[model samples]
Target: MFRKRSKTTENTAATASTAVRPVWTFSSSGWLFLYHFGVIKCLKDLDLHRQVYTIGSSGGSCAGAFLHMDTDIDEVVRFVLSCALEARSSFSGLFQLKRYLKNAIRKFGTAELPNKLEGNYEISVSQLPWLRNRRITKWRDMEDVEQSILASSCAVPLAGLPVNVPGLGYCIDGMFSDSQLIKALVLGNSYFAYHDHASVTICPFYSSRAHITPSEYVPLWWAFFPPSPEELWRVYKLGQKDARAWVIKNRGRTNLTVTPIPDLTDEPEATVLQDGWHAWENVGEEISMLATGAVARLWSALSHVLEALGWTLVYWELAVHTVLSAVVAALAPVLPDSLKAGGSTAMAWKRCRDYYALLLSLKMVLKMVPALGGRIRMGMDAIDRIFSLSFCFRLFWFLKQSA
Candidate 1:
C-alpha cells in the first residue's frame, strides 16, 4: 500500500513542472534570425523544443511553419541562407524599376514563394489530426493552407510582393494583423492547454533595438524611403511602452519573459549596409546580428550556473569580434586607394583572425587563474568604451560622406 502525497508536496511538484516548460514566441525579426541561424539547435541547446509553442508574423511565420513541420534546423538554415545569397546577388538588377516590377509581378502572379515553401517543407496534415473535421479535408488542402499562412506572414508592404490565397483575400504582411505578443500567447496557451493540459510560460523575443539616431537618417526620395529617424525613434519608444504594458497586464497569470535584442548602433560593421537598400540588401547580416543578440539574451535567462557562464563567455566573444570587425571595416574606407587592394583586404582579414585567436588564448589563461573572471569582465568594459568611440567615428565619417 502506497501513502498519499501531501498538499504541500503536490504544490511543489506543480511549481517545478511549470518552471521547466516555456512557450517561445518569436517576433518577425527574431524568427528571421532563428530561421537562418539554427533555431532548432538553439532551442535544443536550451532544452525547450518539445515544450515550446511558437508564434510569429512575417519572417517569424516562416520559422513557425518550420517548427510545425518538425523540420530539422539544418535544412531551415540552408534554405534561408540560399535564398538570402540569391537575393544578394540579384540586388543590383532589382534596382531597375522595370526589372523590379517585372520580378514582383512574376513572383506574386505564380505565388512562387508559397509554392516553394509547400514543396520544401510540407508534411502530412495528419500530424495535426485535431483539425481533421475542420474546413481543411485533404492533406494537399492543409499544405496549401500552411503555405498561404507563411506567404501572408512575409508579405511586407513595398518590400515584399503580396500573395493571394484561395479562401482569403490578398494577403499582406502579418505584422499589420498580428504583431502583438499577447495574441500569440493567448492562442498558444488556449490551444496547447486544451489539447494537453500544458501550462505555458511565454518567452517572447524581438529585435527592435533603439539604435538608429536622428543623425543616421539621410534624405532619400520620399516614395522609396523608410520612416524618418524621429518617427522610427518614436515608434520604438511606443513599442517599449506597449511591451511594458503587456507585462503588467499579464502579471501573475502567465509567466512572460521578454527578450529584446541589444542595440547594434555602436557596431561599426552595421554601417556597411548604409549604401544599399537598407533592410532588403543586408538581410543576412541583420539576421546574424539578431540571432547573436537573441543568444546573448537567452544566456542571461538560463538557470544553470555552468551553462550560463559558458554562454555568457560566448556572447562576450561574439560581441567583441563584431565591434572589432566593424571598427576595422569603418577605418578601411578611409585608407588611401593605393592601400585598398586585394592584398590589404586579405591582410586585414588575417589580422582580425589572429587578434580574435589571441583573445581566446587570454580567456583560456584567465580560466586557469583563480578569481580572474572579474578581470576579464573589466577588460570587456574597456572594450565597450572602444566600441563606443569607434562607432562615433564611423558616424562622423558617414556624415562627411553624405555631405
Candidate 2:
C-alpha cells in the first residue's frame, strides 16, 4: 500500500508548481512594440506564455484587446497591418474631393471602432460559453463594458476624442489614472491572490522615455489643437518616477520584477507602423546569441532580414514623394485662379514642381545613403543621433511656420 502525502506537503507542492507560472504585464508601449514587431510570438517560444495578464492605455489597450482574443499571434499581426493600411488610405484621401465624397457615403454604413470592438468582444465571449457563463452578467452589460474599455484605450488627448461611457463620465486613456504595469499588478494581486500566497511572478515591461512630442500629433482637422509637449513630458517623467517608487515599495511583499525596455521612438530605424522593431531585434539577437539551438539561429537570421526590409520600406523616401504628389493633385482645385488658367493646368504645374523637388531630394538622399549606411554599420546609436538632429531641424522649421 502507498503512504498518503501530508496536507502540508501537498500544499507546498501545489504552491511550488504555481510559482513557476509567471504573470506577464505589458505597458501600453510594450504591447504596441510586441504587436508590431512579431515579438509576442517569441514569448510563447520562450515558454513565458503562462499566466499572462495584460493591461495598457492608448495603443497598449489596442494591443491588449487583440491579445485577449486568445488567437494566434500571426492573426493579431495581420489585423494590425490591415488597420494600419486602412488608416493610411483614409488619411491619404483627406484632400481628395472624390475620395472624401466616397468616405462620407461609406461612413453611414460603418460603425465607429469602439462599437465594432464591443460587438466583436460579445461574439468572441459568446463563442467561449464558459467565459460568458463565468464573467458576463448580461450580453448588453458585457457589450457596454467592452465598449467602455475600447473607448478608454483609444482616448489620446489630441489624437483621439474623449469617450463618454454611461456611468464613467468622460473617460480618457487609463494611463491618466495609473501606469499600465501598476494597474495590472493591482488587479492581478487582488483577483489571483489566495491564502496570502501569490500564484505567479509579476513581470512588468516598460519604457521610461515614451513621451509624445508636438510634432508627433497629426491633427485630424483644422481645430484649436493645444500644443502640450511640456505637459506630456511632465506626465511621462512623473509616471516613470512613481512606477519606480511603487516597485520599490512592493518589492519583497509582492513577487514583482520590473524590466526596463529601451525607448525606440527616437531611433532612425523605427517607423509609425513598426516603432518597436528595433527593440524586438535587440531581444531576438540577445536570445539567439545566448541559445545554442538551431531554431534560435534560424529565428535570428529571419528577424534580421525582416528588420532590413522594414527599414528600407519605411525610410526609402520615395513613398513620401508619392503621397506629396497625390496631395498636390487633390489641392490644385482649391487653389486661387491666379495660379493657373484652370484646375487641370494648376494640377499639372503642381505635379511638375513636386516631381522636380522629388528628383532633387532623391539625389541628396542617394548621395547620403553611403554615409548613412557606413554610420549604421558603425552603430545604431550613431544613426539615431543623426536622425534626431534632422528631426529637431524639421520640428524647428514647423514651429517657425506655425508661429
Candidate 3:
C-alpha cells in the first residue's frame, strides 16, 4: 500500500545518500534460529551482510553473534539443527545444548564483542526488578558475550532458568520487555544520531515492522520440539524467499555506491498516483476482511452458546421433573393414609432415592455443556494463549494482506 512519505521516510532518504549502513534487526525467535539463519545466508549471498549493523534479541542475539563473527553458513545451519535435536530430547538435554551453543559462540566470537559505541552488533536483554529491556554492547570478553547470549535467549518457565547478569539481578528473555523489536530499533537509531535509517527488520513471525513478506506463523510446538528435516527445509526456504522479496522491495531506495546490488529489472513498480489509489483500495479490502472475520467468529461463538443453552434447558427440565417426583415420593409416605392409599413407605423411599440418582446424572450432564463447566478451563487457557503469543497476532495481519 502506498503511504505518503512521512518525516521518517524523508530522513531515511536523506541519510541514504550519505553512505548510511543497513541496520539488520532480528526479533526474539525462539527455536526459529534456522529461519534467521536462512535470512543471513540470503543477505550474505546478496553481499549485504558485510557492511550491515546488527541488532538482536533472544535467539536473534545468538544469530547476531554468528553474523558478527562471519561464521560458516553451512556450519551454523548444522549447529542450529543439532541444538534443536538436543534440546528436544530431554529436559536436562536443554542445559547441555545451551553449553554446547555457548562453546560454539565462544569459539567463533572475538575477544572484543560489538557494542553500540564501536561495533556493528548489539544484543538486547530484559533486565530484572524493573523488568526493562536493555542492550548489551560492551563485554568483558567473549565469555561474557556468550553468557549474555544465554541470558538473552533463556525463556523462563519454558526453555530453562533465567541467567543472572552480574549487576542486573536475574535476567530473562529479551522478549519479556521488547518482544516486538521496536525498542531495540529506537535505541539503535538514537545511538547513531538517527543517521542509521536504513533498516531491514526481520521478525520470525509476520510483523508490521518487518521488510520481508510475512511467512506462515510458527506453531508453539515448534518452540519445544525439533522440527523434522522436511519442516526445517520448508522454513529455511521460506526465509530465503522473504529475504529475496525484501531485496526487491528496497532495491530502488538503496544507495548504489555502497555495494553492487543485483538488478531485479523484471520486478514491476507502481507510480505515485497509482499507489495512492491502490492504498485506499487495500485499506477498504482490509477493513472488510476484518469485519467479516469478526462477524464469523462472533456467530460461531453465539451458535455454540445457543446449542449449549438448548441442551442445558433440556437437562434442567429433566432435573425439575426428578425434583418434583422425589418430593412427591418422599411426601407420599408422610401424608395421611386416606390421601395416599396405594403408597407404601418403603416403595416411596426407594422411588425418592431413584429420583435423587437421576437428578445427579442430569446435573453432571449440565456441567458438561460448553456454556457451563467447560467454560472455566477453556477460558483460562484461551486467555493464557492470547497473552503468551500463542494466539497468532499475525492472523489479523494475514487477513488484511490476504485480499
Top model number, lDDT? 3
lDDT of 1 at 8: 27
Model 2 lDDT tens row, 367-393: 234223212332355333323322222
Which 10-residue window in model 3 sums to the lowest lDDT?
186-195
Task: Tell me model 3's lDDT, rounded to 2 decimals.
Answer: 0.55
Number of backbone collisions per candidate:
2, 0, 0
Candidate ordering by lDDT (highest first): 3, 1, 2
TM values, all candidates? 0.32, 0.31, 0.55
What is the Cα-based lDDT of residue 341 in candidate 3? 17
Candidate 2 clashing pairs, residues 3+ apart or interchain: none
Instruction: Report the C-alpha lDDT of model 3 over 1-403, residue by residue, as the tens digit.
Output: 0111233331132223234666677776767666787788777777777677776777877876676555677676776676666666786765564565676676666655544223566666777767676666567655567677888888775556778775566777776765423322211121111122436667666433355533454544454455665566556666766777767667788652234655645423211111121221133333444566778566545544644554355445445545544565567756654233124656545544543454455443554365353332223343222222211223322333433
lDDT of 1 by residue, 214-292 (tens): 1122232211332333332232233333333333444357543433423434322212113322222122333345555
For model 3 the local lDDT of residue 154 reads 82
Better by TM-score, candidate 3 or 2: 3
lDDT of each: 0.34, 0.33, 0.55
Q: lDDT (0-100) at residue 288 of candidate 3?
A: 44
Candidate 3: the clashing residue pairs are: none
Least accurate 10 contiguous residues by lDDT in model 2: 124-133
